[model samples]
Target: MDTKQLNYYAEQDKILIATDCIIFGFDNQSIKLLVFKRRIAPFAGKWSLIGSFVKKDESVKNAAKRVLTDITGLENVFMKQLKVYGSVDRDPGDRCITVGQYALIRIEDQDIELVEKHGAVWYDLDKMPDLVLDHNQLVEDALVQLRLKASYQPIGFELLPEKFTIPSLQKLYESIYQKQFDNRNFRKKIIALDILTKLEEKDKTSSKKGAYLYKFNRKKYDKLADAGINFKL
Candidate 1:
């Protein structure tokens, strides 16, 4: 170890880094964002995104994953880096920068007790409360990224269960886009994609006649994705 080099580097300014997650889920109707009330000063009791400071041995992605797991108790979910927010006054607590990450998880799959323990609440994306410290901007950017990715990838499936009706799937898309889609066209396009496996079972809850249940074929989607197929819907 070079003592001189260590001493010289020790004089540099130290900046704190944090990872804030924009967690999205579908509740069979609308897309929801998970947030909790701030527990500390400078915005205490205000809505804020779940986050954690990066540990010395962890990367920003890992920190974000840790935050997600702590809050939701689910892992290996769809997560992506949205952007880095380094505005000088973004954090009033300190000179800090935050790496924004967005994640998609099935609403029914999260740990309900854990969420309650942290005072986390799910708010509809369109009706979310104003978040603290530039967190609202983070949410806006994440939604844009989500819509763009859903246009080309089947990533929206992450927010759904294993088996779902076509109508329910259509509802999920409509909630994401915040608009109505033609029922016939949506069904036709989804079937043409050939990424779903039609099951013999039917979901009778939605209707007396029942709608056929389908599951997303991950292997088939992987092959199609590798073949440069686009899932624009």
Candidate 2:
């Protein structure tokens, strides 16, 4: 490292970079978001998205992953960058820029102890409370992105259990899109996709005539994708 280069870098302005995660989980009925109270002075004890400052040694994606793991104790969950928010006055406490990443995880897969330890609570999408800073905007953007992605990609499987019934899957899609789909059409469309394997085991908890469980076949979906077949739902 040359002294001239070191001097040039030292003269540059320093700004804080952060990553905020909008975690969406499905619990068989509706989609929910994970939020916790902000511990900082500017908005202490207010509802806020799970977030962390990007460390000097870590990328923004890793920072988001770290925050997610700290709260949910899960790894390799489906996550994607939604947007970067850099409004000059978005944060009153400091000149900070946040990269928003949204993640989908099965609600049953997370470690409850870790979630509680971090003071996090899952809130229904429709009844979410006011959040700190621009988190509300982030949530709105994430929901839009989620619906868009789910329509063309088989990403909704990330929010479901290993095996789920067709009715349960329909409910999941309805919850995401906030619309009711014709049962026959949904079932037909999903079956035509040929990405689900019907199992003999029945989930009898919902009814006496139980619905048969189905598991998503990721390999089949991947192969179809590689063959240029589109998944539409």
Candidate 3:
């Protein structure tokens, strides 16, 4: 490699660091993000990103997982850093580098009561309240990254229930896509993906005209993905 490229890598190796997780949860109808209520902050009681300083003992990703488990009492959720927000005035407290991560988690699977104990709550992405620091920017970047990844991966299903209605699936897409989608085209695309299997029954609780339920066929999606095929709806 060229010496200039080598120098760039060398400088990257010595950057300041921290971790922030934008935990996204699917609540039947919407995509939610996890935010921590700041206990000690210039903006106390106001919503802020879930975060931690990058300690000498753990890598950035591991520190993120640790924060998730410690705060939410949960583990093994899909965690990946989306971007590093390091504007000089981004944080009012001190000079800290915050790397944001987007996580996919099933809301029903978590212990909500315990989560609240840590001052953590799920914020509806559709109407997020004012956030402290550069948290608003973090959410913006995370959503874009998630949409790009979802187009290629079955990650849209990651936050969904095992059995879901087509409307619910469409709602999930609209939540991420942030726009209205034609029902006919959306349904056609979902079926054409062929990774969703129609369940034996329908979810009749919502309406008299029950919507058919479906589940992600991970096995088929995995095999197809392994063959370099992409699934998008």
Candidate 4:
């Protein structure tokens, strides 16, 4: 139904309010974005964000969560709605207002095989192919928000593995900031956060002496971050 025909009681329930997701993943090497091919509908073969219509008795967040479960098969993941795209021609099907959100999930639990069944694929932000509709703009907006988020909060947890090395952290930060950092200063600043505890054992596979790994201490960081302790590196 178009937006014009939604006022009556019976027609109101049929109104479409959809949600599109910009799911982000980290590969320890570089950041990646998740996109899916349009299996059915207006743009049959074009790449697009994972999306679904708002369901009965479901809130906007619930609709997004259902999309996550239905498409990715991952639950209790990190997600937040970025904005709503309601351009008259945004969705060719009808007058649906699409809520665009960006989600961060651990790569290990990404269910790549299951999602691939729908032709869902991961693309590097720098080298992505042309997307359908305004989906590309949605992704750009989401990335800008993620970059800002990484500043005060260690949003990298959504991307990084459980146990990571200082080099891994540095590289992640560099990818988000798009700049090279002096290793010594980088370590100094990140260590100063006091949220990462050095492990006794090192990752020997990478080298002979190996690099010491660190784990994020969420309990401690939350307490400090609450007190407005700035986190930067």
Candidate 5:
């Protein structure tokens, strides 16, 4: 490489790169989002997605993972890249661009103390508060991507426990679609997928009859998934 070629790239205007995470969690009955009060000057005290500027030596994905771990104290969670936001005045402090990423987590698995220590709060998606910058749009975009992915894949499993009741699974689907599903039809459709194994145990917490507990058969699910099985609810 020649010095002139290197200088050519250096002459271009510099802009800051950042990554924002739209962390979604499901409590088996409803979907929730994690937001925090900004601790910096530009939007101090305002609600904002967990985010940070991309470091010079790190990949954007790593930056997002770092931010998620820092804020939620959870690691090894899979994150999906939603889109990039680069509106000229998106950040009041400087010229910047941000990549949006979303991750689905089981609500009970999170470290509540760590989240609260960082001033983060989990808000039900339907009742989310006003957010800073274009965070609201970021969240909306994440939801669209989530819904699309959930229709074609078994991504909802990430939001649930190892063993769950049929009603719990139905509630999860209903929460994702933001509507009620016909119980009988929903059960028939899900059972037809053949991805779950009914356990002998039953959850008696909700009713006298008790619903059977089922575990996702990952081996079978993977085989079917590889065969292009559609997991639409």
Candidate 6:
């Protein structure tokens, strides 16, 4: 390295880069958030999202995944970058900028023991407690993204099991949007999308006649999505 280059680099501002994740899970009837009580200083014992400072050798996306895996013990889940929060005074301790990301997981698929070990709790979206720093804003942004994505794509399938009934799928959308959908209309729209495969089997737990089982046709969805078809619900 050249001495002049090193000298010029040393004169620039040094800032901290951090990543915060907003993990969302669906429990069939409602959407929930994974949060934990802060165990470190600067807000110890208060509710907060899973987060950590980006390591020198790790990318921001990897940092978020690492933090989520360390806390939830889950891997290969659906995650995406939301946006950056760089308010000058967002972090009281230092000049830190955070890249926000959101993840979607099936609530029943998580490792409960691991979550408990980290003191993480899943709270219903509408009933969550006050959060630390700008975390409240982070959750709001993630939810907005989730709803918008769900409107035009089958991203909500990430929160559902491999096999689910039409009613179950409808309930998931209703919960995400916090509104009730006409059962017949919802089913008609979803079926028209041609992205679901009807199975011979049925889920009998919900009714005497039992609801027929269906699986998301990812291949079909992808083909249609590429053609600019919207999966609005």
- Across 62-159, the per-residue lDDT of candidate 1 in tens digits comes to 99999999999999999999999999999989999999999999989999999999999999987899999999999999999999999899889999
Tens-digit per-residue lDDT, 50-135, candidate 3: 88888888899999998888877778888887987888777777777888988888888888788978878787886777888888
Cα lDDT of model 2 by residue, 28-85, tens digit: 9899999999998799999999999999999999999999899999999999999999
What is the per-residue lDDT of model 4 for residues 188-223, given as tens digits with 9 covering 90 to 100? 988888999889878887789999988999998999
TM-score, per-candidate, Cα-based: 0.96, 0.96, 0.87, 0.91, 0.94, 0.94
In candidate 1, which residue pairs get closer than 3 Å at backbone N, Cα or C atoms, i.e. clash?
A: none
Model 1: weakest 10-residue lDDT segment is 2-11
User: Per-residue CA lDDT of candidate 5, range 180-228, in tens?
Assistant: 9999999999999999999999999889989999999889999998999
lDDT of 6 by residue, 1-233 (tens): 56665656777899999999999998888889999998877899999998999999999999998988887788999999999999999988789999999999988888889899999999998899999999999999999999999889888999999999999998899988989999999999999999999999999997799999999999999999899998778
RMSD of each: 1.5, 1.4, 5.5, 4.0, 2.0, 1.8
**Number of backbone collisions per candidate:** 0, 0, 0, 0, 0, 0
Better of 2 and 6 by TM-score: 2
RMSD of 4: 4.0
lDDT of 4: 0.85
- Positional deviation of 79 in candidate 6, in angstroms? 1.0
Candidates, ranked, TM-score: 2, 1, 6, 5, 4, 3
Query: Model 2, residue 186: what's the lDDT?
Result: 95
Q: Which stretches of candidate 1 lie over 4 Å from their true place?
A: 1-8
Residue 34 miss distance in model 4 (angstroms):
0.7
Q: After superposition, how far is residue 75 of candidate 4 from its true place, in Å?
A: 1.0
Worst 10 residues of 3 by lDDT: 7-16
Q: Evaluate model 5: give its lDDT.
A: 0.91
